[model samples]
Target: MTAHIEQAPLVRRVFWRLAPTRLFADLISKSWMESVIPFVLFVGIFTYLYIANPAFGTIGNLQSISASFSEFAFPAIAVGLTLISGGIDLSVGAIFALVDFAVLFMIGVWGLPTWLAILLAIALGGVIGAINGFLIGFMKTRPVLTTLVALIIYRSIFNLITLNYSEELAVIYIEDPTWNFIATGRILGAPVSAATLVIFAVVAHVILRNTKLGWRVAAVGSSKKAARHAGINYPLVLFLTYCGAGMVTALGAIFYAARLGSVAGPTGQGLEIQALSAVVVGGISLAGGRGTVARAVLGAAIVFLIQNGLTNIGLPGYFTAGILGFVVILAVGADIRWEKNKGKAIEKTLVNPIVFSFASTPDTSPGSQSPLALNDRLKDAEGLAVGLIEGPEDVVVDRLGRIYTGERQGRIIRFSPPYFNEREVFARIGGRPLGLVFDKDENLIVCVAGMGLFQVDQQGKVEKLTDRTTRNWLSILDNSRLRMADDLDIAPDGKIYFSDATDRFDLHDWTYDSLEGRGNGRLCVYDPATKKTRTISHGLNFANGICLAHDGRSVFVAETWAARVRRYWLEGPKKGKLEVFLDNLAGVPDNINRASDGTYWMAFAGMRSPMYDISMRHPGVRLRMLKQLPRDEWLFPSMNHGCLVKFDESGRILESYWDKKAEKHPMLTSMREHKGYLYLGGLENNRIGRIQLPDADQNWTAHDSYWGKS
Candidate 1:
């Protein structure tokens, strides 16, 4: 018996199967699931109705639904327009009833032509809207209170007119065939009024989306104070917006009057409530300035469909009203909550945090004999224009020997030489300017952070050279705009090669990019002859320093976080090929400049540390640190110590310089050899350092070395 039981357990087997519905649900949960909510709700409702009642999907029922939606669609549009302008109009229903009575009174009682009566009715709406506009816009009255008053006054006028002329309004019918046809005709299996609704909705959408008036209204709605500061004429925008909304409501009124062939005091009563409900349900924010007319129409359709479906299913009228009210409350509450927590939610989703353990620290072991082990010699250097500037990042000497450097205030300051005194402003280019170079025509080309590349002439006038580069198709982050443009060098062929360091973060939040340890940088080229900009190489790890070779066949670029130097060939047999020139560096390399004797000088903004190296190997750990820890407590690259190293064409380390004390110069970003003097600049130093280079070519100028006798 024991042997038989063991055999049964071995023979039995079970298999599990997964359904397609589960997979779809998981996919939707991971992506932009909120965007599909409305569509899903619509489909779910339609499916439920189709299964419950077979006739709900028939052609005739759909047509009837479309017809009813067309009548209320225009009023919904009017309410939506006001909502987008950050205001609410409570008198839309009153305006509709007034127009309906006027059109009927004109055509039936006054015997006026149908076309003229319609025009007058629309004009009356405009006139009433102008009154509301003047009081609320110019007098600064509250929109809700002003419109509520107008609603009462208009309704009272409508009631008085109907009571005084009840018999005439009841029996005064126009027998014209054209009027009758317009009111009751069908076109292509749809109501004739449906065409008007579609046409007007399209026109309104275009006006709001693509017109100056639309922009002004949006500005006012976004912030009244900001709109005034931007010179938007807020009162005028508000007045015109209200007038336009009134005209839209009048259009809907005309359609209703023509179709129904009669006017009652309450014909358009409670219509405003339904319109508001539709606008809110359609995802139009009640707080304003953020919805489209198409969304309004969609909301109106949903509301109408729900009502029609409920009635067809034998539900009571009160049930439909109560359900609509519940929906409005739920939608408004959801929208408010979404707006409040949107930033936190996005950060939580995008940020992945983990702990990083180092595979190995930097080569800081004793007796290793590294190049950055020199003592402090920068203290012996002279500080030029010491107290006149702040944070001189990159230094350049013009043909006239004026020291030009970018300041923290977005101004290029020029210090007249001889004694290095007489400081004056060169040009005002917005954003933090990082790299500086001169084109063939003596135009000062600068790579500005947050702003793109720019050119400044001799007359202190600035012009935008190029701000856009070719976009990478598969990039997870947007790389079309230069984020932190760090360094640039002009090639011999009049092409400007620049490195956009870390497109994912700006200059201030650059530590985040380092923590990411992903390739989020690119090398871009701007051609002067064709006036075009394109990206030549992408997927670089924080590409920073840039220098063109003396042979004009290759360019040297530094990857800051990766601690490597890469050579991109521009001509000869290796053209368009990229190869590593230096790897496993002791520090984070910054700006690279060509020496007078065909060598390159590289600056280390920060020497590599143990924890940072370990962090680089475990990206998941770095991500966790970024998400869980405060920025002040986060581990960062060691950017305090200053060092410089020189290399030849074959990537041989020739010599190294250091400022161990960092008393005069710290955080060395650039080191340029000009006339036997190594001029150094730092990202946050108050003064510029000039050190004597005894063995360098004393008469060689960078301008002459690159573009001779220009």
Candidate 2:
């Protein structure tokens, strides 16, 4: 008891000493600090300014500084939208200039009404946006390239219409009173332009935060492939988003025209840098699929402050570009550095509790049996796999009806049904086996958590095929190499579909995986012919199970963290489409199977627990873990109880079953219903169990291990 008393205060002191300020000081001492990178150059600028002149901090100057958000606010908004959607827009400056000149021509030379000219200019923005969207969205062109074209096109046109024409001296005058009010008038002591910018932000926030459109837009940005599976129209949503962005740029162009009282090549010129800087510095990720409008505003304000402050303090004009460039690089660098530092903090938070739990006699063993019993109708589940895998997640059958299972240590054991007795080590691919599927030509595909993809032949030979897709296009942050490749399915042509469950954290760090929406989970595909791996989608909380459609036209993926199923269309007008197949799931989906009856059997790896729900609802738990714990021992929800649910191709819940006590099993990972019997596999279990199903096919026998047996 005295020992406990002494240790408690020691623990308390240790915790207290790790507080923010102290750690920050320690962080600075590390030779590197995240905040230092971006602020390095900016800090120098601010210091030079303050030291050079004390009045720079005055309220009047600050207000004037903030007021200038008007010029580049719209461009920031554009970049933010693309960033949130998980892409970049490099052509914003050229587009802004183009829109500015078009409005000038329409109103001054065409003699159109100011409102009409603005409308036409905005329409032109949309037109330019449509071009960008079509190239990137439909053609699947790289964003940098497509936008580069738009950028060049718009800039060239701006030059031809304004610079070249002005040399001959073209005239387009701005004379509309309402347009002038919008550009110059003040309301509530703030620039009407600023107010308008706020309104733009609010509208964007609503779309991104309040509605399904926002979710879809974000989904597309995170993973175009995953979004397609979720039934999200990639092109349509992205096209619409880009078009809207174009409209926003047009608004900026109008503000420029109104502010300058004319349209010229220089209008809206060289502003993309500021806009991109604002969005990025505000914390919009360069990789996409995660950002907020409020952040955009914050970013814009900072950019405006810097630009205004530097000019006011007598900095050279050339320094503005250099300063902006430095800030942009710093922002990205700082974000990464911050996250790295943040990861260490999170590790502490996550691990300390678990450590404390251990110190307090943590239950390292499997959890106790559930008190509640389930009245389940899914009695037999054997019809799904027909005995491919037998022991806890033992066997996984591919398209060729071949069964592959893992043994005590690392050997991949293959089995067949007719004899159904002698299971031999077909492959020696290491790591514990989790899920499996078949490609078009009957090649076996396996998901080995720490190991990644494995393959086998007809003669019981094994090969370590791939740990991840090798392509220059993806950036997985260290977590990209399939920490836990739980389950997989194949598309019609031969694309290997799988999930990378926790990119920031690995399989063992599953708890921290749930805490932060770090977006490490990803849906990826490997092309056998091309051997190229691409992250079709990312930002998933924890993507798990997978199963392709019988029609060979659509693929379904399970996001365990999101508690939902999503479908991706492989062909037709809706190709590259994604939609939520099911939502608010009762449990985290594990492995999925397509039943003979045309429905899909989704294995609920664990039932819903209020504890898990609460934890998920508050992301701070994860953030705190990031702030405190190490990578491994963070607090996370346990997936101990098992449940199986039936869903049709349309994602409608057909029926469900559960084993609450975990008596027959603990932590069920996959369930295959074959021949009136259900065979189950658990991630951490000793045996496979069977139950008789009332309506399953009687003759549905296990597949012969003819393929993947080399």
Candidate 3:
């Protein structure tokens, strides 16, 4: 037992320790520390400072430190936003200086009201930002070069103002209570600067995560081309993000200059570097559209701490520079480390395979697992007498051990077992039939790509249950479950549960569906008694497969586009909540069926290329791909290599089976085990393949075949 336990992970660990594969694996695995790392660093470094210098821990000193952090924090956040859009705003520093001067000049020199000056400062910043956006977005200038040039131009104008216009600045008073409050005063116990931080944090957080802007910004960053194809205005998204960043930075500068009571030559200068550093520290990549505002703030806090710590300890400028360099190198290293170790990281998230083995028992193993580098094809069936099935999308079985398959020409056909003989069309539908499940009443419940839910009775009579339950746009738009009804399974309560894979695109346009990468598929329950379908869960990604748990307390649904499997608990502490049962699956799971041994069998509509799987982890990469490439050349979920995977109710993967090419199983979308044989169906193939399951019941074909049989 000990030896077997030790041997279990030997291959996996060896594979992971191999640097190339390990690095690829890590990059794809998500890090919870992504959000928590900054906090840990904040506490750790600050605690050390407090212990080293007593004054640093004092409330008054802390207030000043927090104030200091917020001023830079705002500009850094702006930089973070632009960076996420795959650009940089070198003018963030210049804009801040101008806003400071503008506010002072507008209010102090021109006799404008406080509110008016603030508004003008904000408006001017937005306009200038629009100029930056126009250059980068419309002119097609490179982000770094364009922003760098703007930085220089703005600096020249700023210096000219200082050199020639000090006389105009003379009219401004050195102090005003209102401006002072913005910079230094408090409301109740909270510092005003702290309040600014909180406000920006909240607003930025919502825009980047909860709003359309957030998604659009991410889309542009990932791939402008793909975003446009998905109907997103690429340039507009970039322009608006830049505009918003400019406004936020300008406001922050208002507070900064207000605190100082003047706009001087040194005001708002060289701050962009600090902001960039902070954003990188917070995990926002220079590559774009991946990090958050909170991360940028965290990066800003780290910078503030570093500056303060080095100054107090009297470190040399060179050493301080070295520390900043070291920090950058370290963050990048960490990010790279994470990216490369993705598969290893995913392997860690799964329950131990030993525990997984317990779910399948001694006779069973997972069937959808990837095979060993496909050295050769199966030899025994190399010369068998067999009839080929043409373009079979899904395969089902009746109680007498006969196989039923949904074919390409909108028909379901049946084939006798052994040498897999003569096929005959069982029923006809309007379009392709993808998922097939034999229900309690011996009706084959199916998902028809264009037609919706359907059933085939014994004599091949077709019955449409409910397919257009969801509006096409509201179905699977954005590669989510817009409207393409693909697959289904029956619930124990006799309800027909199915997947509307996408409302956005049809079966042939599956690639477009993947590029959108938005949640769209929905899970619906069709009550046969009333012939009504109600959406049970909305916002799934290409909802490809459905299976109710053996106990019927929960259901497992596959979100193929997201490479995720989620469990919806009907009765538990976590009822009605969808939780990630499995994520970053090695394959795109297509359908789920009950196995004879009290487990489920899932077909991999596609297998994941390690490179592609890792790319999903980087929002910037995907968005960027969308922006640059035409739809066809872009990345897609690879269904060419397909498999049959088995899992228990608790999501323990038992084992897997694989066919490396379309020649064997091509996009195997569904599978059902019947009477000692596991039958496979392919969405794009012209044949149904059969594998003998040694211990499976040989008496049963599909339960539907036993209709009226004694």
Best by lDDT: 1
What shift in Å separates residue 174 of candidate 3 from its native position after superposition?
7.5
Clashes of each: 7, 59, 68
Per-residue lDDT of model 2, residues 389-472, tens digit only: 444464555433444667546677665564445565677776767776555455667788788877766565566666875332
Better of 1 and 3 by lDDT: 1
lDDT of 3 by residue, 260-345 (tens): 76668987777988888888878887777688888888888887888777677678877877887788788878766755674556
When 2 and 3 are scored with lDDT, the better candidate is 3
RMSD of 2: 17.3
Q: Is candidate 1 or candidate 3 better by TM-score?
A: 1
- Candidate 3: lDDT of 170? 62
Task: Look at candidate 1 and give me any clashing residue pairs.
Answer: 353-623, 353-624, 354-621, 354-624, 355-621, 356-621, 358-614
lDDT at position 655, candidate 3 = 68
lDDT of 2 at 366: 31
Write down the lDDT of every candidate, Cα atoms only. 0.81, 0.67, 0.71
Model 2 spans > 4 angstroms off: 1-67, 163-175, 337-345, 354-710
